[model samples]
Target: MFAFFTRSIAAKLLVVTGVAIGLVLFLSNLVLISQTRDRVHALTMEQADAEAKSIAREVAGDIGELASAARTMAGVIGRGHEGQSFDRQGITNILKANLEQNPFAFGSWMAEEPGAIDGRKDDVKGQADLGANDDGIFTPYWSKDRNGAIQFSTFGAKYDAEWYALAAKSGKGAITAPYLAEGTDVPTTMSSIAYPVFSGGKMIGVSGVDISLLSLSDKLKALKPFETGRVLLVAQGQQWLVAPTDELLMKPYEEAGADALKTALSSGTGNLVPNLADANGEGFDRLLFPFAVPGVNTTWAVIIDIPHAAINAPVEAQTLMMIVGGLIVLGAVMMALFLAVRSIAQRPLHGLVGDVERMTKGDYASDVSNQDRQDEIGLVAKALDGFRHKLAESNMLAAEADAQRKAAEGERRRNEEERNQSASVQQHVVTALGSGLAQLSQGNLTYRIADEFPGE
Candidate 1:
């Protein structure tokens, strides 16, 4: 069976067909899986980035409101409290009221001396004193002390932070980067708004408000639904702000990201590290996207992992089915080809061979007939039949010619014998007459010739 399979043309064709079908199915499945991974990655990243942008905008809007309030307050308290003799209690009361009204703000306060309050007040008295500076005019209040900057013993120095510097230099609102609070150790971010207080067109003080980072983290956690997979906030080449807390964020990238990140960065969206081994050494397919955050120098990437075995199951089954189907089709084709060739070519040649065999055996009586086909074999069969008929006719004519020749030979022999006999009889008759005449002349009367001789 093995030899036949190897030698048979039909069997070889089936094997080749099966292999071709399997290869086609495998490549098609690979392309499909790769494209699917890319599409899913693109959609997921787009959604995450959009959510991030929306949150950033919301934070920006909240800071905008604080800045607007500060500007309005600064316009109201024109010119540093020179000869103003204003109601300090009423002003303080208004600032407190504003702080109560705006719950988003951790604390809202105003500072004086045009540059005295550097956002670090060691004591509550110092904070209060800064609030009521005689040489400074209250503009607007916008500042928060989440880390207890006003605490007497442990108040740390807070000067020239990014937010404070921006507010003082640009005289505008700014959002600070995320950081750990001094006393609480809780991750916090601040948004500050400062408006210049002017006395006679000369700046005297500034007002600002600070917001906490707790609300932002809460919103980040809820960026996507629970079942919608993972949502990550990564700072380019740094750390992931939000990711699955259980797994080490860097580990997945170190292992799977090696190939996936390369592909994502190079190709934008496609199969990166396909068939990557997981922590347990199981292979998985990974998809990645490079998240380009606005106003940030670093690029954030998102990766998704799916098992290779799961995706390839369908492809394997499909390949098997195609191979079997191709084999069946090949079998049918070969069978038909063989039968058609035999009937058209081989069978007619076999008939001609049979005719030759019969002729060799001297059995020329058998009729050589052929089918009504116009192909080469059929034409050959027709020619053979014609030759056979001519041979039979020639044999018959030769037999007739031989019989006539023998009959003519026998007649010629008989005619020659008769002629010779007739001549002899004539010769004898003449001689007898001659002898009788001679006897009469001799006159021997005694010896008379008997009228009826005994011998006559």
Candidate 2:
């Protein structure tokens, strides 16, 4: 079946057309898919930005509330000084209640003379105790930084300590930055609000609240619709603050981050990057878009990947349909051509047949005026007419020759009858003369006197 189809000209033409159309459609579909991917990425990034802004606004409000509570607590602690012991139980209870109310907060606490202690020494002591010791404790939190980096107040498993020193030196109220829990494998960003508790017009201690990066991750994860599609929280050229999972998104900017910021800053639009291989060496098409998060100098980007094979199904089907249609048209044309040639060849033959039939019936005596036409059939008819004329002339000549032969035979018989009659009369006369001469000699000379004699 395949061989037959391949051999026919119409089939071959259809195959060629099918291939050409398929290629054209394939390229068109690729362009369309890429464009669609870009549009989707742009829309997704816009939504991501709006989502991040909403969350950031909510976090900001929470920080403000925490700061207010910390200020009230610091005032209470300061006023209770000088012969009055601090209400440590009350302060701890308040911090625990606030932390429980906001699940996003990892921990919160107040510290006096934070810079006086060494963070490394505290971290080593905490690890040595295996979390059994609770004295000399410090609350861990992040300081606000546009450059996304892991930062916190403590070096223990519960909090990062890099942000603590910066916050302490800056003497700023609150700090926000990306971080990872010491013991746990999860990476996050925290927003911390710190207030100093004063004693006699001098700074005594700082109180603050901490929010986990998991909150941002949860919000971004909820925005994604596809299993393969992901929303990445990338800070310009630094790192991915929020990503899908450790295997898919947890990495430095040069490692696994979607380079959307570079593309957007350079081109002012989304860019597409195809993955040549996954963990299993599978290839996939991907799209990226960079978006500027509101109220933040740093930018964020989103990436999406799709299978090329799935996107090309419609074009293949359309190509097949076109090929089928072309083949049908070609078949129709060939059939028409065959019929036309047969009709043209048979029309003249019909006229020639009619002329031959007429000639067969001895009808050539009639004038063949129509035979003078200037076509092959007409030429045949004219030749037949000439042959018929010659035959008729030969027949007339043969009839005349036969009539002359019959007339000559009749004349010869008449002459032979006259000669026979004359011969009989002469014989009778000789016999009578002989008898008369003999009578004369015997004195009987009167033989001539008898006119009615049998001898005459």
**TM-score (all chains, Cα) for each model:** 0.44, 0.44
Candidate 1 residue pairs that clash = 79-199, 109-141, 142-208, 142-209, 143-208, 143-209
**What are the lDDT figures for the candidates, one per model?**
0.52, 0.52
Off by over 4 Å in 1: 1-13, 76-86, 114-166, 174-191, 225-456
Task: Report the alpha-carbon TM-score of model 2 versus the true structure.
Answer: 0.44
User: Total clashing residue pairs per candidate?
Assistant: 6, 6
Q: After superposition, how far is residue 388 of candidate 2 from its true place, in Å?
A: 16
Q: What's the distance in Å from true for residue 331, model 1?
A: 14
